[model samples]
Target: MLITPDISTLSYKRQLAKRFDRASRSYDSYADFQKIVLDRLLAMLPLSQADVVLDLGTGTGQALGILSQQLKPKCNIALDLSPQMLTVARERFSALPNLHCVCADAERLPFQEKSCDLVFSSLAVQWCLSPLDLFNELFRVTKPGGYVVFSTLSQGSMPEISQAWVGLDSQRHVHDYMAQDALLDCIKASGLNLLSSQLSDILMWFDSPEAAIYSLKKVGASLIAGDAHSSVSPTRWKAFLREYEKQRDERGVPLSYQVSFIVAQRPAIV
Candidate 1:
């Protein structure tokens, strides 16, 4: 089942940004899954040159170097909702010519229409209150016949964590991921032609549930649901850990992520 969030709340949006800002310093250390998905997303793109490219939600500028090496666009714009993240990206790519770092929301791009030839985002749009709004923004900024390539979490991600909280209280511990069908629908609704999309499961193992939680916290993804006040009692926490351990394998405790990779194009006008 697909879960829709009340992303319209300003407080929720602020909470999301603040959590990411606080996590800026430690994000790169625990972003292994993100890196894996990004590599796969990059592989799916057709080899071509773009005059101008926009890297939306360019966390820590992780994709900057590779994008620069591959697309070799004349200009690369790295944008993010978190100022601290942008700060880190700017410093990381400061020496690269024509690289601009902008602190801006993905849903409301600060660029002229049809200006960019390529738009790339990784594991970022899920945080937006409205995926449709984000897609629309991407479509608007993209030049006719331009491309938008992205990867995001889909439904059934982190089932181990969600399952652990099943018997616990009603408070939400994990953020809800968008259903695959819903995501495809949003892409179609944005007036972009879908080229291809694929869904896959990515798993990460930890020594224990605590280690998994720690990794997530380090990446600032733990508080993604914006449930700042939610807490688990000692008894409940113990039960949750016990439940999570049931999914352990020879590698370690498993954290599963369902990721969706999508490629779309803005049709060129005749």
Candidate 2:
């Protein structure tokens, strides 16, 4: 069974949005991991034209150019929870005539049913309070025979960080990720037909444990309001660093990410 955190509170969501908003300026630089996953996710997308494309959590509009180049959508919708992030994304893609950026929640997308021909999200669904709700929204917005491709962090991500927090206090320090089975169950229940799915263990090497944590913060991924206590004492922080050093390899500290990529489609009208 997967133990997930309760991040459904509006306050937590607002905090998360604020964190991303603050990181908007530096997100592109520190999002190396996200860029890698985005490339992999983009490669997995079947080479088919889409008249309308929706990029959920389209941080800084990274996918806009690529989607335009590959899928050649007539219209592109970039939606995000953070207005500041969307502001940056809009600026980044201002030259694109067909691009539209919207500030909206992934769980409650402000789009009509069957309004999109393709829905793509990268490294975004893991932050949702209920992945099922997001999946359902994706399914609802997708046209018949349309596709939904997404990547999310699975249960084994950031094992070293979690390990380092052990022996300190019982309070959680890292966010909880959904187990693969639990995620699959949600996908199955969402009624979208699974076309392809893959799980990968990608290790990102950092110069130090602090650097790894810093990178996460730079990318707006270090939000801990859901499962972690607000404060960590200086002594506890030092202890965590010492514990984290024990797991360092020759390449430096290893941050293991269990990434899941899934491609699903709504059934075509028969």
Candidate 3:
């Protein structure tokens, strides 16, 4: 359950936090769809009156509202690296007395051992290059037999957007995500008994290609994090649009996403 210092040194996380902070004002605009995915995730949670709970990457405190209404933990820690995100979370959950918001990197959480009875994150760990490191940290913070459940994007999450970039210059504009195989390897290596591992595709239908791309960028979900885009000339924009349209599905622009969900348990103290 030890976190390596290497993850903190990666420059991507800082720039990612900055972009998200700037986009915080507009985050809710594209959040309605994400909420659907989150609702389905919530239906699976094994709820209890836990003494301590940790909500990692609690963006805008959407989950905080539900946690406060349902579990009413003695202490609910909502942690994220983005200051603006924490600001919005704090504002949203102001009425909840037990909740506390802190800015902490996902890969390296700042918590005492066995401090939480449950740990939950939604669509957040995908940002981590070392998902296992974060998973181990989750295990470390949770009490014995506690749950560490999370959901994240899988390899096929953004196929249409990726395919649209095919004709464009290939400079690896987006950050690369680890494959599902690698993710499983990390979880196994963490020494936690995994109760469930499921990956599914949530095919979100958007009105138009521009709308799809714009919404992702508006919520700071753009692929290019901390990377420079090749000069997009006026002509290239036109060509890129044409190439993008070619991959459109029957309704017109196709926006598809695949996701993974996991539920693991910390071994009970013998």
Candidate 4:
């Protein structure tokens, strides 16, 4: 049976899709950090090659080239929430007849049971409303003995943004990443055998505070925690900048990401 998300979850995903659609054109340009994370995630794959591979949340199809060239999957599926992003991916991989683009929700994968040999996602699972549901779908679709490799932001990500908004406003201005322990628990609960997991801190340097924040939005990742419709006053904006500037150092303004690299697999039948 297909998983059915509640009404609110569906609405939230639509909003996320629209925001990402707007960022589709600019996503590749500002996705340097994403590429870094993707590379690390790909390096954790358990198999050298697979018959079928699914690239979840493949924004602008960055991983398509590497997956197709190196892993050489017979069929490569590039999936995302944004239609525009899928369009870009389709155009980029138009020459590759085996590459297919699908717009779908991660929590409710459209694939049949035990269909994919490799389910890979980079910096994407964190966006789902329920990590358990996301992993359940991953577990369901992955062929027995197949692997699932992914990278997601964990707690302590974007410390600068969280700190800067401390006194300026009561609302949260940054995304609240899930704790590593909770994520691990979800993986276990989903019945996927955990192979290995690692946590690392990645820091990016930007010329200024504006550039640092722009990096998030350009990638369609700047989902704030407060009221979306609330307007920020000039004074508050200035205060936020002032607070953020205090963290600048010799290199430039800093944005931190606490990344969790995970590898899991479905147990093979005896």
Q: What is the C-alpha RMSD of each candidate to the true structure, in Å?
A: 4.0, 3.9, 2.5, 1.7
Clashes of 1: 0
Cα distance off (Å), candidate 4, residue 82: 0.4
Q: Write down the TM-score of every candidate.
A: 0.93, 0.94, 0.91, 0.95
lDDT by residue (1-270, candidate 1, tens digit) is: 854445566677677778889989999998888889999988987547888989999989999988888888999999988899888898888898789998877888899999999999999888887889889989999999999999998988887887877867777777888999999999999999999999999989999998888777767686347532245567887888888888888999989899999999999999
lDDT of prediction 2: 0.87
> Which of the two, 1 or 4, has more lDDT?
4
lDDT of 4 by residue, 1-270 (tens): 855667988788888898898889999899989988998887777788889999999989888888888788999999999999999999988997588888999988889999999998999988888899889999999999999999999988988887888977797676778999999999999999999999999999999888887788888886473332245777888788889899999999999899999999999988
Model 3: pairs clashing at backbone N, Cα or C within 3 Å: 157-258
Model 2: which ten-residue window has the lowest total lDDT?
A: 223-232
Q: What TM-score would candidate 1 get against the native?
A: 0.93
The C-alpha stretches of model 2 lying farther than 4 A from their native spots are 1-8, 226-230
* Clashes (candidate 3): 1
Which is superior by TM-score, 1 or 3?
Answer: 1
Better of 1 and 2 by TM-score: 2
The TM-score that candidate 2 achieves is 0.94
Model 3: lDDT equals 0.77
Clash tally for model 4: 0
